[model samples]
Target chain A: MGRWRALANAAFALAVLALGGFGLYQVATRRWHVQPTFHVQVKFSTVSGLEAGHRVRLQGMDAGVVEQVVAPGKPGEPVELVMRLDQRLRHLVRSDAIARILAEGMVGARVVEITPGRPDAPLVAEGGAIESEPPVELSDLMKRTGASLQKLDDLTRTAKTGLEEINAIAGSIREGKGSLGKFVGDEAAYQSLMSLTHRGERTLSAMEDNLAALKRTWPLSRYSDSRSFFEREKVLYQPGSRRDSRLFRDEELFEPGRAILTPVGRTRLDEVGRWCKQASQPQSEVVIAAFTNDDHDVDLAEVLTQEQADSVRKYLIEKHGIDSAGWFRSRKVAAVGFGTQVLRQQDPSLAQLPPRRVEIILFTPQT
Target chain B: MIARGVWQLEQFGRFVGFVALTLAVLPRAVVERFGEVLWQFEQVAVKSLPIVLGAGTSVGLVTWLQTHRLLVANGAESALPSFLAVAVVVEIGPVLAGVLVASRMGAGLAAELGSMRLNEEIEARIVLGADPVPSLVAPRAIACALAVPLLTVLIDASALLGALVGEVTAGKLSPLLFWRDSLVFLRLSDVIPATLKTAVFGLLVGLIGCWTGLNADRSTEAVGRAATLGVVRATLAVFAANVILVPCIQLATEALGLGLL
Candidate 1:
């Protein structure tokens, strides 16, 4: 290298290296060519994966990093985080400055986001503690989610049963059974109906055979399966809590039109009586709802169904020895007569399956 | 085949000897011939900087452009600054800077020494009171080892600047926010070891260049061959060094408690 070229190169090299070295020094010290900083402490019940060296923002502006994490000394004590804030921005962090721990993005690191206090609020002293809002507890959220998922699983099971009933009703309509079957008057339409009926029966049988396979098909099946893996009757009819319902045909519960119990009806009520022994409590409730299409007059339909519901309620209290009333209060045994008013719009479930029926439902309080 | 193996073994043995000799004389040569070392440092570091910055800037700009859309789609545009900072600082900047330096300095040093060897200048120096290894080769070797770390730092800065420019112009993030968020994931353990490893790459460039040129055949064609060999070998060495150094440095940081506050 020549002397003059070396001199020029040295000057250039000195300038570049000096600038780069100064920038590096500033970066290493966390002072990005700006003013100095002061310390502030904030205590959080949970940091939500917030670590030392994570960023602390002031009103979403990048301010500083968490300097030290002093873990709680005893049980139930909050984790204390020491942060270094830019001294120039001290006016923004007041006595009422609220610090919250938030995530940067869906999967990014945790950040202590500090929203500034009112302009009139007094500025906190150096090394002062800022007020904090505790982060959402993951365990509590998971517990609530588990409960919600349990309810959702129950709904999914009921929806499955409803859909199966709809399939059966649709098959019945194809075979000239329900109101929808009135369209099939032509011979060609009848042949098409016959073909569709066989296909529906085959599909229904397949659905019945692959019931467990269907449980594994949906998106939330894994979560649902883990939540309630027991038999449907056992899980759905847990003894002293939630609800258990049984449906009996109107003829099975009462004489053809007289609201009187037959031997077969008595035998059926006995099984329910056994279930009530485990499922009933002093505060437990039983509902007997009866429906009938036997009477043409709406008022007469209402009376007949009402009488049938009353008779079942009476038998449960008298024969099964269930509680009714004492002095101040009574164990509620509500008997509602839906009559011939299937009102498919109001109670679509009533319009389908078993046109004349009575339902017994038991509701028990949670332990 | 046996003869070729013997030749290969002989070459390997001589290479090891040269490496040992350079290591032994390095400290003394650096102190004694400080002026020559400074000149060589300027030649290797300053002169090669423009290309390094250009490469660094383009790499960072392209990385940001590619990543920002995906981040925005996922509502993670906020993570772009810190994400780019960690990637460029710890991995991309050092190795790319090392290779750029190697490409320019490796060929230059080899050709310079090879021409001198062809002209019998090294022989003339040896005939005098001066030793060729210390007076000629050592200064270049020391300069290369020192220059790479400095260049790596420059590359890191320029790449961040390039990414910052993209983010500000297109993504609408303030420069201040970008600068602040960029430091969130960076630490001494990551930056120090990553930049320091480039110095090893520089040492390889200088040594291989000098070794190839000095051991070149005494012909005009050999000078060109030496220059080509210098660049190829140095570039490969830098990449290979990175693969080995990363795990070693990671282990060292954990063992030394560099991760703790």
Candidate 2:
């Protein structure tokens, strides 16, 4: 029994060695499968990492291995891949078979994927070449996609410019500029400005339309309101709305003509800040308006108040951390600065260091 | 202390010469004592099969589990099989076969020869006009040098099977898919050399075991020390040889124009 056991052990060891040796022999010969096979050739414009031992698949079935790579002698010449396919599956390879090189599992070994031809098609002759397709390289695809996107972006820019020109032409006709403007004259512009003061309770869309009409008025271009303060003013002046006003003197908010905030101004605005957080709703509109009475130059007054109004708006949004964006609805905040009134008389009424004031107006829709 | 150091150096030189002498006479010894070689093969390859296979399976399963978790996070779960193939076939299998043999067979060789030395059987053989080195040492050394590469091949196969089984449990890839992907990354160039390199490891194990046993003190306790020292020295030699052999093999393959695949 012991002698037999020793024989069994020796036999088992020899078996393992035999199996291992056979596997090594198969691999060294570059013949992965044992099936009798016939050779076919495929030519590719480019083959990335396609070696002699890369797999060959017939309609997604593992058929054989790439036998040899025949490189072209010169540039622009195709690389030829010699493949061996199982003789049993020889009928599947018709003369019109399409061969493509694809990567296995996203980044694995490159394989030659052969799409079998139609059943009616004749079998491809042994050692015959098939129709080859170039691989779709990711970098080339990206380049093509990028070029397409750039073309789309350029088209969109041209479209936007065309619309802007059309818009300017329409405005020119209303405000009386160019040949087309002489027909409608300034009466259309005057009518739009008039409609702004009397626009009644309307839907938000109608409000936008009215604002668009007002924006088309003469001298409206020089207003320079990025926040569309005129649009917010129309929304604020609804009937049955309660307006609460807080006034701070120019000395309280700024240093002379500049818009920079002072410590005293910040301290005073804390009361308004508390009102903003506690008393404000999503529907409420807060408008910061600064009035200046600089005696001689109305332009100086306009510049001072404009800067002050902007400064107050910046502080209100930033210092109090009033979230400008919300999921459901956003806060409607506006800032406008008004210079001193221009009188009809040649000489304007002047005051010496008259107190210029900043007003924070909160307009809530009547509940 | 200086004299002791010089003596130790001379001892090392003798060990080297003994290894060289064993290699020089290996072919003749193997042919003459073919039966002894078969018996040692029965002991080394067949008996050591269970441990090597179990270690291989565990290595594969652990490697699969680890590479899966890591690659899945990087959105490269597709690369698991390729990574597993390269890791196991190219690096893990050879080293593991060496270490496993070192741990198992190293001490067995030491104790077997140690007992003979303690019994003065080696002295008796020398007196009887027979050299124990050819009769005993050469056959065991030949067994290991031949057996280790076979075991390494077994381990590689078992580890790959373990990975396939792991993939089955994971259900991420079918058996056919895992196999296809696994084969896609395996190159004969890497597999052949990596598997064959363990022969050096086996030679080290046999030499160290024999060297320790023959050089042991005459005391009974010296046998135990020899056995323990056999495992430690053989295991260390396997690792050190692997470190040296890898670059040498790389350069050799490159010179042969079989540059690393």
Candidate 3:
């Protein structure tokens, strides 16, 4: 019985030893998963909070562990972190991929987070060094945030001062202390200003009519007849002839329903001027015809087109000095407004052609 | 009250002397009566397995449950096995085994020795030219010193198993994964020194138990008192030895450049 008891005791001891040995074996072999792994290195400017055994994550998924943290051997050299990542995830770590050390929580362990490269990028080879971005120090972030807050405070103070100045100006206007205040406050001044604006408009219209009649009377009469003939034949002219026309959309020239040229329109016109100078012949005539697609009100469209044509001619003659009196005397430039009539005459079958447009036609006498 | 205090201090001084004497005589005792040491080993260690395993498993489960909840809040639930393993293997398992053994075996040794002293058996040995220190104290002390470390290994294994059970029941991890993750932070430096410290705990338990028992007065009531005193003193000695030994081991490992701790 005593022998049996001793044997039992020995067996129990063996069992205990076996249990402990098994635990030790698990620890030593690291038999968690049979998946293969490969080694890679990443260099960082500062690995302050990182440790050797901390996890390495590939795009937020647990991939492997940091094997070693090697301090810089030479001054100014970055710290090297050796990592053993799963072999299957090798494709994720590409040549262009970057590894960053990130704190898991406010006070938790730091982990290496690898941002994947483009799918087509070459895989990071074994023993190769991948790129690393140094973790943004909390102090640096706080300093930058503090500077931005200071700038915001200054901006608020400046805005407050500007608002105060605006308030003072508004108060002056309310009290009838400025010219604008007088316009609003005094009935006589407001009536006079309105009458003056009306008179100016009437005078401008009268001058335009006089100018038109003058052009038809004397030295410009021959040029006006030639331009009218050119306009009449422009639609029926053969395509192969030495005649080129460039079309500019309404949005390219002016804002909707307005005759004023936009900056983009001015730029387009500059290009046209350059092209005209290049293509000009001794007998070449340049015609600027403005058209509108106002099916609702043809009269208003005609007026708008005429005003737009005049504006373009005046800008070229005054701003660009493209007048007949210039050294380039061979070029003859004229303005004409066809409004919706041009659309109806050109393509009568189509219900709608396009938006408002300006066509610049350059014609040389077909030799 | 003053006399009682003096008497307690004297007893403590004698106990310390007895521990020193036991250490001095250990090598000769092991050589002379190794079989007797094995017998005591089977009695003290084998008999104490159930209670030690239970303590270890319960402690591990509690640790895992509490740490899991805490780490889950921080999104670090994956680190639970590693934390529990390090905690159990390096600190909790050895200390728990020591304390348990001290309470169970310390009381038993004290009562047995107290009864023998009361019956004049120790006097009979001395009269027969057999030294009571070698025949009586040495075998039991050596057995305890040897058994505690082995028992600590058992405790560590049981605790790890318990952690596995806890993790599995929580439905967050598989047994295989838990076992793998548990080794993440474990180091040889942590395991070796921690296991070795239980030997010191065992030595303390044996010396205190025997000292209290042999010093008991010749009465039936004295046997009970000796047993109670042995348990209390041995338990305190285990804690005190841990406090001293832990730092010493830490410093030694650091000096050796192990850096495991």
Candidate 4:
């Protein structure tokens, strides 16, 4: 049994040696699959992780494996890879097939995948090469996503901050705290209303005075005697001087020598003065003071007392019945109307002083 | 102290035996003893053609697809040949060949040697005045050395074939144009270094397996251990050789002014 076993071993050894020799012969003669059934080559910019013997696939089906990888002769050119595929697959492939590198998944397992070419193209020959298409890398996608997210975050934050600032401005305006507040609030509007009221009042008063003067001159109806009254006043009063230039012509009456009180004028004034003296009491001098919203003037002319003015008015009403209340109310009193010689003729300096003028003003108040 | 010294001496003896057998191995003598190393070569390298071709073809297809993908990204997918040619010639040919040999032949050789040692045949040869080193060790060593380089060349060729198949299958390139471009840039350096590295790897496989078998204890368990250790050591040595040799070859080539050409 041992001898037989040894013989078997020897036979096996011999067979192995014979086969090995045959294989060697085949290698030398280039007989055993030396020529490729079909060939293809591809190029790449970088093959940093890829190596020869990496598997090649077609739609996830294994087609072949990598044979070789090489750098180009020139700089900045693609590195190349050579591959061989099964002979049976030659008919399916066309000249326009695309080859690409892809990762197995998110982490990575580099693989080369080939897509079949257009059916219209000519059938591929043995030992052919193909062009490669670039695939998107995970790192690139991640970078772009991160940048976009960051931009979105920044935009949202900016919008939020702007909205907050606007809210603050609106709140301040509601509270009426700033310049905008003054425009929006009611106090300034109320103040403007009060100023308008004062202006309206002054306008109305001036219009009323004008209306009163018109009422006296021209009555509204036929029975009214407003025109007759105006005619009576025209006859009773001396004709006031008429001048083309009114302001300059009025100065002539105040000239020293012009219209000096004559004897007839003095006798008429004395008669009026005697009646004024008889009507007025020596102890009880009635004083009429004129007051306005704004006034500091102390003296102008010797003004009549209330009693003297009342006596004159009574005498006119009882004897002549001249109703001149409109004239009285309309006149803006500058000085008291008095007989001219009885006037003290105070110096202009004394008249200008407020104290001395006040003393003189006490004796002749505005009626 | 004496026990430690004796252990050290035994380890040193084993190392020396390994070296001596490696140096003494003869390819022609191994062929005579094992009815020609070609027999083992056929079984180890020839039969491996299908697997090598499959692997190489797959590698080529993958490389073609990847390179094309990248080239398309850069808008330069046309220059596939030169790239593939240089890669196959310089890197993939020898390294993958070594890996294949280690996986297929290296492990088998160690197991066979371990089984022989366990069977007492090795002892019997020693008693009969037959040197096991020349008989068993030399044949396996020489066979591996011869087979590995030869297998590497086939692998390279198969890979190129696979690349062509991929291109044709994809219909992206013409076979004639691919070869023309690939061959245009290929050089002797690409071929020589690959074969040389494969041979070196083969020698490492034989040396590691034989050394482990010869140093194993008399126990059956020791033989098993030796075989497992042998495969492990051989694989590691093959990887180490690749790492060291590639850089050395690159430096030497550069020193000689060899580059892309």
How is the predicted docking of candidate 1 categorized under the CAPRI scheme?
incorrect
lDDT of model 4 at residue B96?
Answer: 83
List the TM-score for candidate 4's chain B: 0.85
Model 2: residues >4 Å from true position, as ranges?
A18-33, A117-123, A170-367, B1-12, B71-86, B111-121, B170-184, B187-193, B216-229, B243-261
Could you give the CAPRI-style class of model 3? incorrect
Report i-RMS for every model: 3.6, 4.6, 4.3, 11.6
TM-score for chain A in each prediction = 0.40, 0.44, 0.44, 0.40
**lDDT (0 to 1) per candidate:** 0.81, 0.81, 0.82, 0.60
DockQ order of candidates, top first:
3, 1, 2, 4
- Scored against the true structure, residue B116 in model 2 reaches a CA lDDT of 90
- Measured on C-alpha atoms, candidate 3 has an lDDT of 0.82
In the range A1-367, model 1's lDDT, one tens digit per residue, is 7789778876776776786667566566663224588888999988888877787899898788887789999999999998888888888899889999987667756888998888898898889998999876678789999999999999999999999999898888778785567565357877888999999999999988687576545545445544543432232243566666789998887788779999899999989877876665777877777877755576677678878989888898889855543344567777777667553233355456686888887878678
Count of residue pairs whose backbone atoms collide, per candidate:
0, 0, 0, 62
Judged by lDDT relative to the true structure, which candidate is superior, 1 or 2?
1
DockQ of each: 0.17, 0.15, 0.23, 0.02
lDDT of 2 by residue, B1-261 (tens): 999999999999999988888888789998998888888887898889889999999999888888888888878876787789878888999999999999887899888889899999999999998787788888889899889998988888899889889889884888877865676556677778898899999989998999888888877899999999999999999999999999998889878866423
Sort every candidate by TM-score, greatest first: 3, 2, 1, 4
> For model 3, how does the per-residue alpha-carbon lDDT over B42-138 read when each residue is reduced to its tens digit?
8889888789889888888889889988999988888888788989999999999899989997898899999999999999999999887888899
Docking class of 4: incorrect
Candidate 4, B1-261: lDDT as tens digits: 999999989987877766775576674465467664545545566567678778877888888888877766775555676678668756887778777777776667667777777788888988999777777777667777877776666666677787788778773679877765565334444456656777889877877777777767777787777767877888888999999998888888768754322
- Regions more than 4 Å wrong, model 1: A1-4, A25-46, A58-61, A70-80, A87-100, A114-134, A137-139, A151-367, B1-13, B164-171, B174-184, B254-261
Worst 10 residues of 3 chain B by lDDT: B252-261
